[model samples]
Each structure stands twice: as C-alpha cells, then as structure tokens.
Target chain A: MIELFSDLFSDYTLRTVAMGAALLGITAGSLGGFALLRRQSLLGDAISHAALPGIALAFLITGSKAPLVLMTGAALAGWLGAALISSVTNRTRIKYDSALGIMLSVFFGFGLVLLTYIQRNPDANQAGLESFLFGQAAALVERDVFVILGIGALVIFLMGLFWKEFKVLSFDPDFFQTLGFPVRALDHLLTGLFVIAIVIGLQTVGVVLMSAMIIAPGAAARQWTDRLGRMIMLSGCIGAVSGVGGALISSSIPGLPTGPTIVLIVSSIVVFSLLFAPNRGIVFRKYREWKSGKQLRVEAVLVDMYTLAAQHLSAEYPHSARVLDVMSSMSGPARRTLGLLKDLGLATQLDAKMWSLTPEGVRRAELIIQRQFGGEE
Target chain B: MEYAIDIRDLTVAYREKPVLWDIDLQVPPGVLLAIVGPNGAGKTTLIKSTLGLVKPAAGSVLIHGKPYADQRVNVAYVPQRGSVDWDFPTNVLDVVTMGLYGKLGWFKQPAKKEKVAALKALAQVGMEDFADRQISQLSGGQQQRVFLARALVQDARVYFMDEPFQGVDATTERAIVDLLRDLRKRGKTVCVVHHDLQTVPEYFDEVMLLNVRRIASGPVGEQFTEENLRATYGGRVAFVSALVSGKK
Candidate 1:
C-alpha cells in the first residue's frame, strides 16, 4: 500500500491520468445532479453515445487528433443529438425515450463506421483513437489534463452562476416561463453544458460507460441529503474520490481498466448509500417497520389483559397465560410480552400460571381502549 | 378605464387541436374573479396563455393596457399543486424564495434581505416554523399554502392561481380564501381557476363560466346561472344545478 501511494505521487503518467479523471468526474457529477433531478438520466446516456460521431468527424476534418478540435466537434455533435431528441419529441408523436434510443444507436453506429474507415489508413497515430469507445485513461497526458481542468472549471462556474434559474427550471419550467425567464434558452444552455461535461469525459471514461460517471455520483449523493446544494457538493466529492481511486487501482494492477474500475467504485458507493443512509435507506426502513411491529405486539397483549379484567368487573381478576394468548389472537410470544408488562409494573404474576393488572396497568389499558374506540361505552 | 388584464381573441392549441378558443376577457382592478369550468374545459390553458406560458395560435394578452412581456413584473402566477414534483430536494424557504428570482434578475443570488422576505411570506402562511423543513415532508395542505406564500413574496399587482383549493384540507382552503380577500382589500386583482361551484358566489365577486369558449362572464349574482352552467358542463348540469340550488 505504501509502495502504491509512492508510485501514485511519483509516477508522472499516473498523476496526469488521475488528475484528468478526477476533473471529469467533478463536472460530470455536478451536471448529473440536474439531469437526475429532471428525470433525464437516459438523456445523459444518449448524449455521450451521440458524441462519438462528432469525435470521429473531428479527426476526419483536422486529421490531427488535437484535444481541443476533437472536443469541439464532440460538443457540437452531442448538442445536435440533444436538440434532435427534443425536437422529435416536441413536434412528433415520438416519445423522449424512443428518440434517445434512436439517436444513441444511429450516432454510435455511424461513429463506428467512420472509425473503421479511419483505421484503414497506414498512420500509426490512429491506433489509439478507437480507445474513445471504452476509454484509455493511461493515454491521457498533461495537456489533456489541462483541457479537462479548463472545461470542468467552466461547467462548474456556469452551474453556480445560473443556480437559481436552473433550480427553477428543474422544479417547474412552466412557472419559470411565467416569470419571464428565457426558458427555452436556459434549457438549451443547460443541455450544452451537459454535453460539454460528457464530451470532456470521452477521453478518460469513453462513450460506453460515461453515463455511469455522470449519473452514479449524483444518485449516491441523493440518498444522503434532501437539499440540492448539499447533494451537488456531495456528488462532486464522490466523483472526485471515485476518479482518483479508480485511476490508482487500475494503474497498480496490470489487467484492470480505469473507466470500469471508476464505475465499480461509484456503484459500490451507491449500494452502500441505498442500504444504510438514514430516512430513505432500505435498512433504516426495515428497522423502523420491525420496531413498530414489536410495539404493536406489546400493545396487543396489554389490550387483551385489560379486556379480561373489564369482563370480570375487577382489576384484581387473574387470568391464565393460555386464556390471554387465545384472546390476543396474535402469533407472537405472549409470555414474553406479559413479562415485559410485568417489568413495566403494568401487570403482576400472582403465580406461575395466572396474571393480574396493576392499578397503573389498568389505567394504561383504559386509555388505550378509550383511544381505540373513542371513549364509547 | 384600463383593466387589470385584457385578453383578445386568445386561442391556444395543443398538438393542432384547440384547447381554448376566442377567449376574450377583461378583469377589472381589485376584483376577485373565479374562472369556473368542468374538467378539460381549458381552465388551465386560459391561465397559461394569459401568462405567456403557452404560445397562442392567434391572440394577444395585455396587463394594464400593455403586453404581458412589458408588464411581467406586475404579474405573479401560482400553478396547481400537482404541476411540480413535490419530492424535489428543496426546503420550504428556498421554494418560497424562488418567487423573488425575477426581481433579483439573472446571475444574482438571494441575500439576507431576500431570506427575510421569504420568512415573512412563510409567516403569512403560518409555515414559518417549517422554513428549514424539506418540502416533501409537508402535508398536502401545507404544500398548497407554501405555494401561496411563494406567490405572496412576488408582491405583484395581479395574481393568477390555478386550482388553489384542489386536494387541500379545509383549513388551507379557508386560509387561501382569506388571503384572496385580503389581497383584494389591498387593491390587487386576483383570478383563480376554481373548480367548486358552490363557493363561487361566496368567494368571487365575478365569474367566468368557460368550456372551450366563454359562456358567460359577469358578476356572480347576474351571470352565474343554470343555463350558462349547462352550456359549460354539457352533461353535468343536474349535478351542478343541485349545487346551485343548494347554495341558494
């Protein structure tokens, strides 16, 4: 572990790759909060896949695989794909999900065809371009890291500047329209930012799994808080951690890939949050239900004991364990409940077989009965 | 006299089918007007068009003798409770503060003064204690009240509320009605897309009975009658007439 830490700090390639992945993670995670809240998770998937044709076309046009040119091309193509999906759903009977699916396959398939055509050339540099499909984090250099940082900073700054407008947009676009906001313009701006964030990640995470980088951090953060501001901050943190951790682990091991490793780390965070976070987590909900169930069982036994005393017209009337169990009608441990009542001074055991209510128990039972039946005779 | 709101030849369509047609209306200042119609009667469409949320096929909407765009600062809208996702990650205070976003303009954050105003609006709705509480934790009635408080913070001269009483409890309904009356007393024009016909005469000074087209729009005592209700509701006249007579 110490050797791995030293290598992470000393190895220049690992440092550049790790920094690039972390920057991509922060921007993608922050933007993903908006997408997740808007119920547009699939749109992220579609946009990333749709970016491929642009990346390929950028290479075709420039013939030089510069990061800036390729990213610009990728951004344009992703934006066009998003616009097409919106227009198709808006103008025609096609639903959003179907439009997204259609765009994803067509754009990605076109990109693959273009990629194959490019591979036919005898250029050695073209060999690594296909890595944009699954990503090759190891190929990232200092220049690429600077590009990622610049784009990521711009995205995060835009998110903060338009925080209120975007919040209103996600919560209620109709009301946002009524407020004289340029709703359509704001929407396109947000989509452009989302596309930028995705485009920047294509080199580190690739198109196929970039959506997971976009969505998982936000989803995990959502489980931990009920405030958008906190959720966004936490998502950025989770994304950063996952990015650095995945980069380190993948570099340390020979066979593991960085992108999938990042996804795996983030997915594990999501799973842990889903099971253990307070309020909305599954484990917490189950514990609450179990506690309520136990309380109900105890109340049932108390009510049964009270009913027996009422029928006999005396608080000192003793009833057998069998009679109380039969009256309670629950398949619970009746004797254990009776012992709990005795411990609470609500009931007293006269002998091994019979039990009677204490005065405090009588009063408690009467209150419960009154509440259940609204004080009726 | 310049009316608070004037809509001329307003027509709105969804997917090539008109939802509201030839809707001409002029609401006077400081009057509480209720727009009553059955389900699918374009009640919501009327409000949306007046606020420029929906693009009209052919029409114009003016507030205070000016186009809606020119008079946006003078108008505030409260959509139906069901229009927004209640489970969104926001506090009551933040949701209420959104009413001030237009006034704050672009790229400017809300400050201490804005927070104070939001808290004041919450107090008006008796929700000051729940300022920090997440919105989804609120009850349906509380949620409706919070929406009302948001509109209150806008401090606009004209307010449009769409079905403010739908799904709210009795206390919230009374609170909203009281708030409407209070707004009118302050010389503000308030128009509500109301569903309950029984309370129309009690809650509104004027009524507009609408289907796809306007049936009648005048003082409740003069224009709200069985014939116009029949024209608006089509087959629910019997049920509506019972409510009308029951009110009498």
Candidate 2:
C-alpha cells in the first residue's frame, strides 16, 4: 500500500492521468446531482451516448486526435442530440423517454458507422480513436489534464453562479415561471451545461459507461443527505475520491480498466449507503418496524390481562396460560410475553399454571387500555 | 372602481380541445372569490390562464388595469400540493424563501433579512418550528401550511391558490380559511380553485360558477344559487338542491 502511494506521486504519467480523471469526476458528479434530482437520469445516459458521432466527425475534420478540438465537436453533437430529443417530444405525441431512447440508438449507431469508416482509412492516428468508446485513462497526457482542469473549473464556477436558479428549476419550474423567471432559457442553459459535462467525460469513462459516473455519486450522496447543497458537495467529493482511487488501483494492477473500477467503487458506496443510512435506509427502517412489532405484542398481552381482570371484577384475578393465549390471539409464544411482563414487574407467576397481574401491572395495563381505546371501556 | 383582475374573452385549448371558452371576469379588490365546479370544470385551467401559466389562444388578462406581464411583481401563486415532489432535498425555510426570488432577481442569493422574512411567514402559518425540517418529513397538513408560508412571503397584492384545502386536515383547512380571510381584511384580492361546494358561501365573499364557460359570478349571496350551481354542474348536481335548501 505504501509502495502504491509513493508510485502515485512519483510516476509522472500516472499522476497526469489521475489528475485528469479526478477533474472529470468532480464536474460530472456535481452536474449529475441536479440531473438525478430532476428525475432526468436517463437523459444523462442519452446525452453521453449522443456524443460519439461528434467525436468521429471531429477526428474526420481535423485529422488529429487533439483533446480540445475533439471535445468541442463532441459537445456540439451532444447538444444537437439533446435538442432533437426535446423537439421530438414537444412537437409530436412521442413521450420524453421514448425520444431519449430513439436519440440514443440513432446517434450511437451513426457514430459506429463513422468510426468504422475512419478505421478503414490508411491513417495511422485512427488507431486510438476507438479508445473513446470505453475510455483509456492511461492515454491521457499533461495537455489533456490541463484541458480537463480548465473546463471543470468553468463548469463548477458556472454552477455556483446559477445555484439559486437551478435549485428552483429542479424543485418547481411552475412556481419559477409564476415568479417571472425565464423558465425556458434557464432550462436550456441547464441542458447545455449537462451536455458539456458529458462531453468532458467522453475520454475518461467513455460514452458507454459515462452515465454511471454521472449517476452513482449523486445516488450515493442522496442517501446520506436531504439538502441539495450538501448532496452536491458530497457527490463531488465521492466522484473525485473514486476517480483517483480507481486510477491508482487500475494502474497498479495490469488488466483492470480505470473507468469500470471507478464505477464499481461508486456503486459499492451507493449500496452501502442504501443499507446503512439512518432514516432512509432499508435496514434501519426494517429494524424500526421490528422493534414496533415487539412493542405491539407486549401491549397486546397487557391488554388481554386487563380484559381478564375486568371480566371477574377483581384486581388479582388469575388466569391459566391456556386462557391468556386464547384471549391475546397472538401468533408468537405467550410464554415469551409472560416472561417479559414478569421482568417488568407487570405479571406474576403463581405456582405452576396460573398467571395474574401485580398492582403495578394493573395500573400499567389500565393506562395502556385508556390510551389505546380513549378510555371507552 | 378599478378591478383587481380583468379577463376579456379568454379562451384556452389543449391539443385542439378547448378547456376554457369565451370567459370574461372582473374581480374587485378586498374580496375572497372561490371558483367552484365539479371535476373537469376547468377550475384549475382558469387560474393557470389568468397567471399566464397556460396560454390562452385568444384573450387578454389585466391586473390593476395593467397586463399580467407588467404586473408580475404584484402577483403570487400557490400551485396544487401534488404538483411538486415532496421528496425534493430542501428545508421548509428554503422553500419559503423561494417566494422572494422574484424580487431578488437572477444570480442573487437570499440574505439574512430574506431568511428572517421567510421565518416570519412560516410563523404566520404556524410552521416556524419546522423551519429546518426537510419538506418530505412534514405531514400533508404541514406541507400545505408550508406552501402557504411560501406564498405569504411573496407579499403580493393578488394571490392565486389552487386547491389549498384539498387533502388537508381539518385544522389546516380552518387555518387556511382564516388566512384567506386575513388577506381580504388587508385589502388583497385572493382567488381560490375550490372543490367543497358546501362551504362556498361561508368561506368566500364572492363565487364564480364555471364549467368551461362561466355560468355565474358575483357576490356570494346574489350569485351562488341552486339554479346557477345546477347550470354549472349540469345533471351531475342532483344533491346540491338539498344542500342549498338546508342553507335556506
């Protein structure tokens, strides 16, 4: 582990790749937080897949694999895809989900055709163009790192400047409209930013798995918080950590891919949060239900004892275990409840067969009966 | 007298199907008007059109003798409770502070003064204790109260509330009625899309009976009658005669 840490700092190539991946994670995670909350997670998937054709066209036009030129082309293509989806859904009877699916398949299939055409050519640079399919972090150099840093900083800064507008947009666009905010412009601006975020990740996680990078951090962060501000910040941190961690692990080990490794790390965090987070987690909710079920059983046993005492018009009226079982109608063991009641000084066991309420137990049972039935009995 | 709200020949259509047709209305200030009708009566569509949320194919709406766009700052709207996802990651105070966003404008954050104002609005709705609580943690009644607090902070001269009393507890229902009356006492025009026909005369000073077109709209005592209700609701209102007779 110590050798791995030292190598992360000492190896120049590894340091550059890790830095670039970290920047991709931060921007994608923050913007993905908004997409997740807006219930547009599938849109992220569609947008990422839509960037592929633009990347191939950029390579065809420039005949160079430069990150800046390719990324600009990718961003434009992604924006076009997004615009087409919206227009199709808004202009026709097609639903948003169907439009997204249509755009995803059409754009990605065209991108593959372009990629195949490029591969058939006699160009040497076309060899690594397919790396953008699943993202080769090791292919990123210092220049790519600088590009990621600049774009990531700009995206984060823009997010902060429009934070209030975006929050209202996600929460209630109708109310925002009533308030005279430019709802359409803001909506388009957010979609444009989402396209840029996806464009940046095309070379890190690639189009195929980039949506996972966008979604997992936000999904994990949501389980831990109920505030948008906190969720965004935490998601960014989760993304950055997983990005650098996956880069380091994949570089140290030979065969593991960096993008999938980061996605796996983030997925594990999401699963852990789903099971362990306090109020919203499944485990905590089940535990609470189990505890309440036990309390209900105890209350049922006390109420049954009170009913038995009432029937005889005596405080110390004793009933057999068999009689108490029939009266409670509980599925669990009656003896277990009796043991619990005895521990609480609510019931006394006389000799072998009879069970009766103590003075304290009678008072307790009366209080439970009154609270449950409003003292009607 | 200057009308607070004036709608002239307002007609709205959705996908070539008309929802509201050839409607004209003039509402005076300092009155609580309830727009009551059965389901699919375009009650909500009327409010949405007046606020410019739903586009009217041919019509004009004016507030204080000015177009709605020019008078946007003086208007506030409370949408249906089901319109928003309650699980959104925001606290009650943050939701309430959003009411002031119109005045705050773009790229500006709410300051300490705005927060204090939001808290005061929450207090008005008896939700001050829940200022820090997540919106999803609130009960249905508390959610309604929180939404009211949000609109209260807007401090608009005209208020449009859609189904504020729907799905709320009795206490919240009474609280919202008192709040509406309080708004009227302060000389603000308040319009509500209401569902409960039995409480129309008791809660509102004026009533508009509508089903696609306005059947009748005037002072509650003069316009809210069995005949008008029957016209608005058509054959679906056989039980309204009994209710009106009981009131008599």
Candidate 1 segments whose C-alpha is farther than 4 A from its true place: A320-345, A348-355, A358-360, A367-377
- Best model number under TM-score: 2
Determine which window of 10 residues in candidate 1 chain B has minimal summed lDDT.
B239-248
- Model 1 chain A poorest ten-residue lDDT run: A324-333
Writing each residue's lDDT as its tens digit, candidate 1 over B1-248 gives 99998988999989889899899999999999999998899999999888888789999988999999998889999999999999899999999999999899998999999999999999988899999999989999999999999999999999999999998888888899889999999999999999888899889999999998999998888888888888888875677777777664
True contacts kept of each: 0.80, 0.93
Model 2 per-residue lDDT tens digits across residues B1-248: 89999999999998898899999999999899999988888999999999888889999999999999999889999999999999999999999999999999989999999999999999999899999999999999999999999999999999999999999999999899999988999999999999998998789989999999989999988898899988988888888888787663
| lDDT measured at residue A162 in model 2 versus the true structure, 0 to 100 | 98
lDDT of each: 0.89, 0.90
DockQ of each: 0.82, 0.90
In angstroms, the error of model 1 at B220 is: 0.9
